[model samples]
Target: MPLRASLRPGDTIGILGGGQLGRMLALAAAPLGLKTHIFCPDPQSPAFEVADAHTIADYEDQGALERFAETCDAVTYEFENVPAGTAAFLENRVVLRPGARALEISQDRLTEKQFLEAAGADVAPYRDIANEGDLFAALAAFGGQGVLKTRRFGYDGKGQVMIRAAEDTDTALERIGNAPAVLEALIPFDREMSVIVARDAAGTCGAFDVSENLHRNHILHTSTVPAGIGPALAETARAMAIRIAEAMDYVGVMGVELFVVPSPVGETVLVNEIAPRVHNSGHWTQDACLCDQFEQHIRAVAGWPLGTFERHSDAVMTNLIGDACDSWPDILRDPSARLHLYGKTESRPGRKMGHWNRITPHQAGNGSSGQKS
Candidate 1:
């Protein structure tokens, strides 16, 4: 059955996975007068601090999951890796936006790549590798040097090993714990870009401006809006994102990461990966756009019209990872920076604790001003 027309203020939104993403989602819901309930296994989940209610239970805890579903008007998840059965359980009782099918396809690298290619989007050439023989075959077919990524559960540089002609296939497979994997021919790309697109229940889609991403150690370090790509390629990136969303009948925010390759006269983009929920690359929109991706997602899942993706300014968003957050006081004193802290207590290395956005008016030269977070 289709969801009821609209969710009024005071309606509670139940979110699975409690981290910075869930925390931000809860923050966005509150302005609309909606409450958020967080369900996560971690007792110290940062999102639990802001949520109106919370349950510290495993995703597979049926009794706890059922109670959570019964208490909220609707449900959404912060991460794509929520156990499949957990989603099935909640969805059986409540409306889970973006749906289980979306999760199933995007959570696995192989499935995601196949789906994008089938939808007519260009993706890096890849082959499935399950064992030593398969790896050898893939290496021979792809010139011996490539990225071997675990077919499931890999993200931000984890679950991946580089494969070369000289490397032992048995050693590489053991490194990844003998998991199913995919080997892709590494592409020489000029730069990386991402599009954050939102779709409402009616299937109306809206896309934000392109964001050029910077990665360090396989983790996103910063995202700059108005990616220096030519106008034509920018439009192409947006269309690819919209195509993915519409093809999936997606409801809520979806991110399409791309590799911008140099074309004859300009540049062309190729799809890299699809993130089925609000993405880190769109963090700039929080201060620079009319509707932030978090709120846009809430609106979509709540049966409201998708919000505008128009940016009010050119912006740079920097992530505060681990010790990078130690300079919080200095960042806070900067007037040009809009700072956001994830409310995490520990300073683990590579952990995304917060972000700061520096926005400059369209006509401002050299950027508006450096605002400290």
Candidate 2:
């Protein structure tokens, strides 16, 4: 079934994961006179603090899910790795934004690449790795170089290894727990960029400015808007995002990561990964745009009109990983800096503690100015 009407004020929205994304979504909902119910098995979920209501139960707890679903006018998830059974149960009971198909495709690398290609987006060459023999053959074909990644549950450099030689294949497979994986041909390219796009039930699409990203230790380090990719390349990135959203009939905000590589004709982009929910790369929108990605996602799921994604400033967003968030005082001292801290204690290495956005007056003639994609 599809959404036939919009949700009204005070309606409850259920979220599947209780992380910072869910917390921010709940925060975005309050001003719209909406409420949120967070459901996660973690007792100390960061979202649990901000949500109006919450249920601490496993995804397989049908009884708990039933009670939670009945309270929500519509439902959306914060993460893409939702249990198929859990998503199926919710889909039958209430509206689930981005739907089951989006969840299924985004959960696996092989399926995601195929979907991107069919959607008319360029993607790197990749092969499914079912065994040690398969991995070795794929690596050999790719010039003894490729990225071996688990098909599911991999993020922030987890469940991934670089296969630079035949000798590295055994250890690479062992690192990923010998799970089914995909070996993608290495893309020798320029910078990394991502486009954040939102699609409503009525098929209206809105996309934010492109973000030029930097990564460290396989985790995102910074996302700078305007991407400095010039107008043509920027438009190409956004067009690719729109095509993907239309292809998926996506009903919420999504992040489309890309590799902006140099082609024979000119600089072009290849779709690297698709995140079915609000992305870390789009966090800059919170401070730069009038209507940020979180709000856009909520509007789409609730069947409301999309908001303005126009930016008034050029901004750089940096993730405060681990204990780096301890410098909140210095960050607060900077008048142009907007700090956002995820309410999580015990920050360990590689953990995403929070992020801050530094905004400056928009400079004109930089390719993206007063343009809404």
- Specify the highest-lDDT model's number: 2
Per-model TM against the reference = 0.95, 0.97
1-373 per-residue lDDT for model 1 (tens digits): 5555468899999999899999999999999898999999999999999999999999999999989988888899988998899888877888889899899999899899889987888898899987888888888888877888898888898999887665555588788889999988877899999999888988788888888999998999989987877666777888888888888888999989999987686778889899888999989989988789999999988878877776778889999999999888887898878999999999999999899998877543322221101
Task: Please estimate how well model 1 matches the true structure, expressed as its whole-model Cα lDDT.
Answer: 0.86
Lowest lDDT sum, 10 consecutive residues, model 1, at 364-373
On a 0 to 100 scale, what is the lDDT of residue 305 in model 1? 84
In terms of TM-score, which candidate is strongest?
2
Candidate 2 clash figure, as a count: 0
Question: 310-372 in candidate 2: lDDT tens per residue?
Answer: 998999999999999999999999999999999998799988989999999888877564333
Report RMSD (Å) for each prediction in the order shown.
Answer: 3.7, 1.4
